[model samples]
Target chain A: MTWLRLALANLRAAPLTSLVNAALLALGTASIVLLLLIGEQFSSTLARDARSIDLVVGAKGSPVQLVLSSVYHADVPTGNIVKADADRWAADPRVAHAVPLSLGDSYRGFRIVGTTTDYPALYAAQLASGRFWEAPMEAVAGAAAAREAGLVQDRRFAGAHGLVDGGHEHAGQPYRIVGVLQPTGTVLDRLILTSLDSVWNLHGEHESAHDNHEHDHDQNPEDEHDHGEAHEHDHADAHDDARENTSMLIRYASPLAATTLPRQINTESQLQAAAPAFEVTRLLNLVGLGLDGLRAFAGVLILTAGFSVFAALYGALKARRYDLAMLRCLGATRTELLWSLLLEGLMLAALGAVLGLALGHGTMELIGRWLAASRGVSATGWVWLPTESWLLLGLLVIGVLAAALPAWQAYRADVARTLAG
Target chain B: MTVLQIDNLGFSYGQRTVLRLDTLTLNEGDTCAVIGPSGCGKTTLLHLIAGLLQPAQGSVAVCGQRLDALDASARDRFRGHHLGIVFQRLHLLPALDVLENLLLAQRLARVSPDAKDARRLLDALGVGEFARARPAQLSQGQAQRVAIARALVHRPALLLADEPTSSLDDDNAERAIDLLQDQARAVGAALLVVTHDRRIRGWLAREVQLEPPA
Candidate 1:
């Protein structure tokens, strides 16, 4: 039998001690591996979703909320900005491209975002089939939204008035699906796109319906018909300043805009400008506090595991003293015995590392599925970080270090004295 | 040929002398017993001969190579190549089965394992059926036989047994002595048995007596 085989047999001799050592190491590794996976996936997905959009300009509110609502479409928009004001900023020399988004409607819990074609260009989203919307009532469905809502080209579906389900449905003003977008692995995958006029027309009808109810309280029902007609004309003649869009996604034309644009918009105008990069960093720092605690917890577990392995090996060494002597009598050199003990420690460590990585990835995949369902953000376990290789190397080093003392004792063991005793 | 020789061997623990011996020699295939009382250092003498201890003063040779002339590692190598030892307790590794214990001896001796030879040794020792049984699972007599098989598996030139039959009844002790001597003769190895049990003296042709120094 090989020395490694002997080491394995030795480990098997005390199943409980070996198992406890391996388990402690596995728990420590799993914690760190889980954190590494989730942290990397979270930040990368956040960064990918927020790419290209330098600043989000919207109604005055929390900068983080604005970024969340406008960039990720994961939350409700703070409020709306006047269409004319957003258009004026879109024309600014500092702005490379500005895509206006009008929110506040949904078809089956998937938001119906009324935006220009430049919005698709923002994500570089391409059509999977069919064509883009050419009219106010024509709509395009994102890949996830299309598959989830069973939307196809030429299918007609009326959007609800609110971003959630059970809102008042615009049954009379149904939209025709003109296209479906390919998956961009971004927030766009969860949205239905339409022209801005579709939102205006839909809400205009609701306002007129409210006006008709007021007429029923005072004037005759015949006046409601004429009043609705008048409201339509007023909507048609209304100045652009009176109309509003929810938020404007702005890209900087030059690096100088990064220094001046947000400050200029926040101070000179009635809009809030949130830089995605800055808000994301602040957001990460806040989450990082909790992550730091977990990291420290994992660190303690790993050190304790190292200690446990050492104790197990050292304890076993005491019991196996006579065995060592017998091996010496059988002509095993001190170095051979030493390496065998080290091999035992390394074997336990390798087992822990493999189990830990498998557990980490499995848990992350489950979490990713839940997040994809609850929030619109996509997080996946399929990604591997480079640092994990270092983690494996570090675990092996811990194995060798944990075995160092016991191996030294085995190396220096006095065979004859031990045998005589 | 002189398979074992010793001259003026002496060992001490600190200032206290543990053992002292005059000249002794055993030729190839010779059988002898070193009989003594408790604390007479018969076990220590066996250890010194096996290269497990460096004597304070002595010239010990096996196959005409002086042990003290070689480095520690070289001595270990020489012992592995030339000597086999059976202790009083028959220290078979509890982890390995009877067969694997013999295989372990060959491996530790840096020789390519000969499973056929190991099996044949076990069979000759009459513990062939217990080849796959763990040391813990075997009876004391069976374990002793397995230990004997392990010692002679590599066919060493010198065989050392310290108190090999001290724990057995007379009949078993005689059988154990007969097995050891017969195996030693088969392998052409000189056998040295150390024990405080004077009963073993009758089984060997030559006898040496050890006494605590005055």
Candidate 2:
């Protein structure tokens, strides 16, 4: 109790210095917390997307990119496989279902994925308002896409030419928004989805009919009337054939078959297979390297904070010599004097740690909101209290040890000379 | 019987021998004034007697206990229980108020200082009104009074003051000397005041002069 009183007195003596030390410690703690939060959120998003698809088959690009385009709805497919090759895998008895994807054009920055209705069911996506697209040129927007583009059900918008910028004319074939998906807390929340036939017809129409000399091989001279009728139908459908797709998303029933099917398709067919889980895991490993570096930087910062604590306490000891001498003269034992100084440092560390925890949690909340608003992904704000508590305990122990050096010096001081001088 | 006995006591820092006293003794209730020129080791002798430093050669016995035979920690405990010390510069803790400073002495001796004892001590010293004032706020004379109160608070067997009158004028010095001696007597403790100043010699029952070290 006596030592506690002395410790409190010493802290009250130097309020500003104590506050500065606490602030430095808090800064280091906050950095570590921010790094951990970002890493966790990134990994969680990847894991969530991986769970949606058993396998993702796309062009032979980087496996990570394949997963990013197919499962995460980020990036574009390198190339597309023939629909005839996809039909062969779909007919297998071992295959429970196959969902093919065709991708090419985009609306703003969001990719427009042309796939079957099974895509929403595979992702367990729910409609926030209207139903999924059933006809060609009808569109289903992810929550992020709808909210960002200000598109509601039954609203129509012209498709952009390239994936990145500028709209192109399909003449009269504008896409109608038919559905808006509920927020899925995953990358799927930021995509525009439609049917494959819509994209294929648009591109076919964009091809000039003046180059129709090659079409005569598939026509017969005796079917002149039918050929004339077909040519009239092609002109009527010219607006629908203004756009073309470049990629497809394929899902296999079992992971074992999905793994084998992509290789088979690549060997005998013109398609490739990409596994979302493997690619996402690989991406996390790559990201983990950067997170590890950040953690190391935070460790160095904390070490510096410990050193600062040592220097601060050591400097304060010189000014406190007289006070210690007076205590000795007043009947304080050397041990009591040492304990008092140690207790003061411990108190400062404990207070700083508690404040740092609060600060870290608050920062996470702010970042979570910012990421949700700016990046279209919701960051989880679950408190990792156990890890944080352990960190604080370790810091407190280091701080106590740092303080012991000065306390030992005070204990060994020559009481009489200190008082006499 | 003597309360403090010093025989052939010697102390030095590095090659410079500061004190070499052949003999000194103080009986209970006796007040002795140690007088010498500047740098004459009066304070050194007082420190040796207070057990703050060990004599290089010879012995010091306080209340018939051999202080030189004890180790550092034991000597500190013995000092806290049996000795009162008033430093020349007062050395009051600047963080604590005047009353807290006095209470600190009693606390160090493991004796609880009740409000009554603290108020009584303050009233007797004529600094009762400044009990709550920090040491930095007190004037030199007032700080000196607070230091004296702290030294005597534990009712120690021996009281050692190092040049308590050096910083005060004659009038304040006389008042300080009277208060110190009276307080020591009232607490039934022997007083040893080390000073080069000769003006306060009248307050002591005996006078000893330390010669320059040979």
Residues A100-145, candidate 2, lDDT per residue (tens digit)?
A: 6777677877777777777767679999999876667889999988
DockQ of 2: 0.51
Specify the CAPRI tier of model 1: medium
| Predicted candidate 1 versus true structure: per-residue lDDT over B78-142, tens digit per residue | 88778899888888999888888999899887788999999999999999999999999999999
> Can you list each candidate's DockQ?
0.65, 0.51
Q: In angstroms, give how far residue A206 of model 1 lies from its true place.
A: 5.0
Give me the TM-scores for chain A across all models, comma-separated.
Answer: 0.87, 0.81
CA deviation > 4 Å runs, candidate 1: A205-238, A369-379
